[model samples]
Target: MILRRALWEGLLSLVEDAEDVPWILLGDYNAVIDNSEVCGRAADTSASMTEFRDFVTAAGLVHLPFKGCPYTWHNSSEGSRSLWKRLDRVLVNEAWLGAWPQSSYLSALPRTSDHSPLVVLGIVGAQEAKPFRFDNFLARQASFLQSVASVWRHPIHGTLMYGVVCKLKNLKSVFRSKRKEKGDLASNVRQAKEFLATAQALHEQHKEDIFLVLVKCCRMVYCAAVKMENMMLHQRAKLSWLKHGDQSSKVFFRKINSRRARQRVYQIYNSEGECLTEMHKVTDEFISVFQTLLGGVRRRRTIDLSWLRSDANYVLSTGEGECLILPVTEEEIKEAFFDISEESAPGPDGYTSLFYKAAWPVIGRDVCEAVKEFFVSGRLLKQINATTLTLIPKVQMPSQVSDYRPISCCNVIYKAITKVMVKRLQQVLHLIVDQSQNAFVPEIIADNIY
Candidate 1:
């Protein structure tokens, strides 16, 4: 155990030295992370599990999600004496995930040995361009609101949604120009530091009033540069708050890179099981699967709900149901906006809740009227409700579109509309939900259902 602990520490040191590049550790360590990885009557694995978990966590490695045989090793004993365990697996670092977000492994059946063979499941292709994403730090700028307001002043002759859409569209160019002006944050910090150092050097030699003023001005500029750089890093890294003592910029960049890498769809498998790297072909595969699944023909299977209806004792009254149909109030609209996290992912609009919250006072009337107009007229612009579908790999090596989970990122206004409706729905849920089904009900502990 002592020798193993020492080896873990040694490996940790090595990993830290080359943390910039993609790395993975794969082997049969003859130890399992938990009791689930072991089967049959074996000695207490508590100490071993703790040690292995500690090493993996401290080393900042993650288990590569795999498919195929769960038990990689067999004891090769008869009946009751037979034992199985997953002794072989793969572990990866953030750089590896950043390099191949779709990467996984397969545990093939053992042929000659008791241990199963493992194979890395992934294919690398050319990188694609990323769409524009709003930087959270930009919203904090003093000129941000002014820039937005300047463009928004233009009158767009259309529906309320169209007007808001046009205004947002104009603001995009403004924000882009702002980002270009900001340039590279890291470079800015470097230049600022260089200027400050020169000022300090001259100040030491002269010690005159002019040099003293120059040093202070340079110092202030350097501090501002550092603040902007750190803010940009924090937003990209998606950290809620940064610790004052820890100021590692590389960590933040790595997180942002890893997230971007993971979201890129490099390739997919066709029905014939051939790997495809072409982007258009992959797009067609996704469209075909989703179209068929969502609007496809199905078996004429009818479910028997007569027994359930008869046994059900809970149902909403007319007044209770009327509450749900009541018109959404402005308070509900504001509450929904406040409920969403400022840093949460944005849709095609490239605008997050932060923009809505920060600029509420300026655009509040326009937004409220827009939302209210939708409910009154029963019409909403497609752009306002446009969604961005992000695919997440479900299996070790997702070949087909079905193997990937699709998450839809809807526009904030559209989300806010639904959120207000959900708030109303939540109030009446307890009236209709059975006492036995505890999940999602107010004041009902889900564990009690167990």
Candidate 2:
């Protein structure tokens, strides 16, 4: 008979849920086989052992076989007063039994203790070791060589450029087979030879300075572009703040009630009017504080933020987190606004106002003129200094003198010449805009400010 009842409160619980995995419960039961299992046993009919058995049964556990020594506990009394007991047992469910039919249980006797050692035996599959490849060992050495070569080269260009050139050359075979002048590969090879010759000439004149200069200029331009992007991000964040900053004020005045509900409705209007006046003062304080922060302005006079938070709703919602929703009291509002005004009181650096300093310069002439016109119309600033400054890297320090390079340097010089020619075109456009600011305002600078 299965006698199921609570034992030790909720101590011995059953496992009702099972995941997709083989499970086995093999451990000592600390129970007896029966009353005959021990001669000097006390209360063999106790409910403790029955409760454990019921838990095992409810959990769908299957008891396994006992091999050599079944008795797990023995009383070591003098002579004929000794008794042996089966205190340990093994239990596993049907899932493990069906999965591994050859698996068996081993129960060994205790040497110096009462509990016995239990072991689960099964015929598990063998796993084979993978074979080593000579190419793998060579691959590691090749990677090490590649890393060392890259480090020695110092700012090495990636092999991807060669791959791109090769793909472009492949187009000669792909689109036009053996054409002479217009063939892609033929033209590319000719251009490559010319580049090599120019590089050789540049090397002969100046060894490394020209290349270093160009690289430094490129990096500087890249950094400037990055800075411009950061400024835009800051502007975006400020705009977003302007849009959502008034939400707290909206939350403040959502609930309103009369000061005295019992008085005649029309006669009690005076006190209600006073309450509303107090509320407006609170709202005004909120706006003044926020606007002052955005304006980056400071005042010598004290400003109270609490005069606006008059309603019980305002007081209750003033607490932190969700739990502190008790309407803010008049004292609380005074304390909060006092702290704000004290912290907000003026200081010296008033000249460093956000209003005066523009974050970036107007790049082109038309943009610059438009900006100047806007400020002039608004009476913000009298004049702005729009000077043409070339954006070059801080490194490289512009050089007027030529240096020696290998005969191969001519190829590099030719490339540099092409770049310089492009720069000259840009300079011409800039000069024309600066000279004829009124005419170029709509077309030139409007196309490119960045």
Candidate 3:
């Protein structure tokens, strides 16, 4: 306890003497932030945790969120004697937080020691163009509906599908403009507080009717500004505060940073055993790996299905065959749109089911027509089918591009169309599929014969 106090005083002294520069003090500080940070034993309120907390508060430090095991150190004991505590942490001040908001701390599994290893990931560079998403908070704005309607109602010359695409594209720009016009929530909150302070002072001096009214109005605006700030924080945290009680803004901000860090690929090794750290080099390596895998020439083998004719059980009935090529209807298209998940990640075109559902009144007819045209012409729009390929790591600390699996994110329109076709096929799938082939069939047993 004496050593902990001395260390806390030393940290405070350092913070006071050092300039306001970005710095991260991480590692085993032999202290837990709160009771929740410890397990297997009741936390002692009278312990040195308060001293550490006070030190952190005085230093204006923020704790970065960690991924993986919650506890960093564990006691090697059996039964009730076993204990775990998060003695290691990555703390940063306001300057550090501002400089690298996307930085993260990863708690790796303990290998030769009882304490888990901590890995601090630094921000790499400016992110790519993020796929556009509809912010639910924006729905609360008074001008939101008007803005969307104004942009979507504009006439566009072309085919129905083309017109819908044009209008959505135009609306995207309008939304972007409005987002900018809303300004920074932090700045707005500060200004609102200043206005409220001035109004309160005036009301105190004069105690007149107009001053009183001004103070009340200012108070309302200030409260709204604070609420908006909380809303923004909630969105960034990507967690519903209603379900899980209120989480500190600092904790939410750190979670955002941790998420970004986990998704980021900083470096990778090529097949030649050469490590590539530069952003462009790593990107080119990934491209080369994918190209070799996906762009390779292949010989197509022809399979005769004459044997299938000999087996009448494998053949589709006349009615079933006819149903396969049935025309897609507007109702089916609308159902497909509504069936898709609103929160699913967007593709390269930056559109989700939520956006379509929200603007359905204005763009539904054209969107339906566009989808129907694909069936008529047997050709899909390139933009609509364009996908964003993301790489998911197959193992911890993956070094090679091959160690990651590539997943494609297709646009919502394409997904909906495919979903409808799949639903139709599923209805007749059991009829033609052999009983022995239980792979794609639902509720089928294929026990090993060997």
Best by lDDT: 1
Task: Please estimate how well model 1 matches the true structure, expressed as its whole-model Cα lDDT.
Answer: 0.79
Residue 402 error, candidate 3, Å? 2.7
The per-model lDDT (C-alpha) reads 0.79, 0.36, 0.76
TM-score to native of every candidate shown: 0.68, 0.24, 0.67
What is the alpha-carbon RMSD of candidate 1 to the true structure?
6.4
Clash list (residue pairs), candidate 1: none
Candidate 1 residues 314-403, lDDT tens each?
Answer: 766789978887876778788888888876778898888888888777677678778888878888897887789778778645667888
Candidate 1 has what TM-score?
0.68
Candidate 2 lDDT tens digits, 1-450: 132244312323433455223467656555654564555535367566666656664555555544446566676765667667776666655455556634556667677776677776664434345221111111122243333233223322334222322332333232222122223332343454455556556666777888656555555544443333323222222223322223322121111101011110111112123321233453454345444534645555565557544532223232222332223233332222223211111111111112111111211222223333332343221112111111222222111111111121111112222333343344334433443353554455555543
The list of candidate 1 runs beyond 4 A from truth reads 64-71, 96-113, 118-122, 176-289, 296-332, 389-408, 420-450
Judging by lDDT, tell me the better candidate of 1 and 3: 1
TM-score of model 2 vs. true structure: 0.24
Please list the residue runs of candidate 3 whose C-alpha ends up more than 4 Å from where it truly belongs after superposition.
1-23, 27-97, 101-134, 154-159, 189-237, 240-248, 296-313, 430-450
- Sort every candidate by lDDT, greatest first: 1, 3, 2
Best by TM-score: 1
Clashes in predicted model 2: 41
